[model samples]
Target: MYACIAQWIPPLERPRFIAVVLYAIGLGTAVALPMCGMVIDAAGWPAAFYVTGICSLLWCVLWFSIIYSTPAQHPRISREELQYIENAVRSSGTSHNGPTRVPWKSMATSLPFWAITVTEMCNSYGITIIRAQLPTFMKNIFGLSIKMVIT
Candidate 1:
């Protein structure tokens, strides 16, 4: 999804756009955490999961309905916006020919790939632990209910 958004953004604006997108994601997570905790406290843990799942489904539906791979393919895009995107793509010298074939065997044996894999694995482990345990930790250590912890 982000790759698609990146493709639409002009090269000169891409860095700032990506930064904003990342910040928005962080902001969303920050907001969602307390909201989830409140929901869990009110209705139980499964209700929080249900709310998130429904939101994900709605987002997917909206994305499929509104988003196009290219400006030309979009039904409601303005002519000026389409032209602007086309001009940017032409100026950037980036082709939309799609990705080159991966050298799987070489990547499998590469030290950099292994390093990145290890780093990502560690990051995922840390995030998962925090996500799965934070509420419990707060409940145990602070003697707070889910709503109280969040509030």
Candidate 2:
């Protein structure tokens, strides 16, 4: 998303747009996590999955409606805004002549890719462990009810 923002927004606006996007992600997680917990308590874990899945589909619909290959291709972008973005991108020398082909083999062997993969694997392990065990741990050890654990 940060990468996408760099493509779609002008340089001066990128940081602000990225901050807004990050804030939105945090806010949505704060709200939706508890909502998922409540849904799980009321219906089941599967119900929580259903709710999130539907939300993902709706978000995809919104994304597909608004997104385009470039600022000029976007249906709702103003001429000034489009020109600003294009000029900024061009000035920065990041504008591509055409679709760049992925260097899949080189990427597979890259140190940065391995570093990111390892970091993500570690992060995912920690998050998954907390998600799977925290409620049970609180219920058993701290005597917290599902509602208390959620909130």
**Model 2 lDDT per residue over 1-151, tens place:** 6556657777777778888987896688667777877988999889999999999999999989988877877888889888889999888776777778999999999999999999999987986787667668888999987777687
Instruction: For candidate 1, report its TM-score.
Output: 0.82
RMSD to native for every prediction?
2.3, 2.8
Clashing pairs in 2: none
Per residue, candidate 1 scores C-alpha lDDT tens digits across 1-151 of 5667655887888889889987897687777789899888889989999998898899899989988887788989899998898789768886366678889999999999999999999988997798778878988988988878787
Residue 31 displacement (Å), model 1: 1.8
Model 1 lDDT on a 0 to 1 scale: 0.84
Which predicted model would earn the best TM-score? 1
lDDT values of the candidates? 0.84, 0.82
